[model samples]
Target: MDIRKATIHDIAEKLKITASTVSRALNDNPRISDATKKKVQKVAKQLNYQPNHIASALRSGKSRLIGVVVPTANRNFFSSVIRGIEEIANSLDYKVIISQSYDDYDKEVQTVEALLNARVDGIIASVGKTTENVDHFKKILRKGIPLVLFDRVTNELDVSQVVIDDYYGGFQATEHLINEGCRRIVHFSNSQNINIYKERKRGYEDALIKHGIPVDPNLIVFSKLQLEDGRESMQQILDSKIPFDAVFSSSDYSIMGAMQVLKEKGFKLPEDVKLVGFGDEPFTSFTEPTLTSVNQKSIPMGNFTAETFFEILNHKDQSNNIPRKTILKPELIIRDSSINKEKPKDQTNLEVIEK
Candidate 1:
């Protein structure tokens, strides 16, 4: 077996052509005839010649690669967003490298460093839950790399960001529960430092105030918004002896956890306690009583994120002038969990409320 790696020179030698001609033909340069280009490509494949993209990037100062960092790829929402990002990115001839931080600050920092070292042209990220200090992200802007953030974001960094109207989503969720004859609603949220959750909590509060319902401190539960966290929050609420008529969670996972606890405690959904969740996860519809949720428009979110990234990339010189902020509208999906009245099977309760 040949231990040495094949190069353009090897392909040229085998095809009896100049190395320059081989390179031009491999790159599909118009100066090279089609027949020659095809012949060169065939020989290059036969020789297993791999182009050195790193070397090419070093010379041209462009890797033609984009990096995306998400908290986790396990959720359907994140995966859908990734798909949307890829749809636009692949069409534009740029390859995307996805990195998961698992919502860990240290891991997010390391991933950003690794992407920078790889010489990616740009980076798109959703800030992790534990990322209090954004110096690591600041380093990217200092190095003149275009960074775009989506979903989970921070106002501390002046960069382009794409997010759904979280405040509206929260308000809608709470207002829907209110309309369902729920006065005492439990709001499950996460860190207030994160803009999305903060805005959501604000919306929740505002909706209560708008409806003449006193905002109860005990009704608002802040947690990591995981399934277990939801369980703990619900148990705490139950133990506190607060008579809540509805529950609105910022995450579907947490809401699902609350549902399980409610079932265990012999509380009927909608009849006893209405429920609404954010991020219309696929499993929401498959539950015993389908869950009502806010659709964050994952597909459109991804498309806008990629578009913003490219916009920054195109205007790299002016990227620092004024940061771009794109906010998309969210949809509320109504289902059995929040509806007290009997809904028809074929009825689609998708509401796109304008804010």
Candidate 2:
């Protein structure tokens, strides 16, 4: 009636092999041949072998775990990034723990503490939208735990970050609209405190100015850039009787909402108003008039973020040599929503620009 968990030693005894050999095989060590590793693993599984992570942590002084914090996992962009991170993490025999902040600053702070309490080797995070005070992230640095930020990054903390060139993205989106004969374009943006949004807004303005179009403060609507926010902003623009022929939103969700309102108002897309959005969310392509958007390169962002974390963790002495900021180029996916001129229905639509 007694039951106990099987150990590496038990597997070794069952296979008539040394415990060290069994351990190396279990770890998929290069020294262990594939045939030996397969046999050892099969036997270990048959014996219901379970690794003692606590003992391993105690001996190695590492949990062999990584923490990832994101605003939410519902979005394709965030989930894709997490997948990319797992690809690298799994290869290194490390586990990833994901925490959701739901865009709350207090919750983000709590998650950092919780991850630290769990003794994670390092943390990879995308700053929450409402997180203006980054003291919680700074605390991780004080403890010497590697922290890498991606996507929603902050300049307040001096840490490694992976992000797309948002300024270039905004510029490209705005310039594309202008080239399509869109003047008096309305813009949907979020808080200016976040560097990404700020840079995007800057790019939008500069692009307009470069085309001899004066930047109109009245045309820029600032909000949380959610779907509801997009609806409200579009309504506001309509109510103000602002003459506009295009809309460029920083978020795909918001632009989708704006598109909904525009349709409800009996406006014909492209013919009446050209539209462009950011993030290049998958849903963009399936909409009535497929949306043109900025692709953030989520997969590469996640890979680079994890790589940066390992760099900080494994090369603490060479920290100064590591680049503080890594920027990925953004791609513009041209689609029906942003095109005013007539074209073939089967035109391919991907444009990669240099930084």
lDDT of 1 at 308: 77
The local distance difference test score of model 2 is 0.89
lDDT of 2 by residue, 1-355 (tens): 1115888888888889999999899878999999999999898778878888767776777999999999999999999999989988998988999999999999999999999887899899999989889999999988878889998898788888888899988999999999888889999999997888998999899999999999999999999899999999999999999899999999999999999999999999989999999999999989989999999988888888888788788885635645478888788888999886575433334443322
Instruction: List pairs with backbone clashes in candidate 1.
Output: none
Which regions of candidate 1 deviate over 4 angstroms?
Answer: 1-4, 319-321, 342-355
lDDT string, candidate 1, 1-355, tens digits:
2415788878888889898998889778999999999998887777777788777788779888999999999899999999999999999999999999999999999999999999899899999999999999999999988889999999899888888889989998999888778999999999998999999999999999999999999999999999999999999999999999999999999999999999999998879999999999999999979999999999888998898788878874754557878888788888899987665423334443322
- Clashing residue pairs in candidate 2, if any? none
What lDDT does each candidate get? 0.89, 0.89
- What's the distance in Å from true for residue 90, model 2? 1.7
Model 2 alpha-carbon drift over 4 Å, by segment: 1-52, 316-323, 343-355
> Model 2 — which ten-residue stretch has the worst lDDT?
346-355
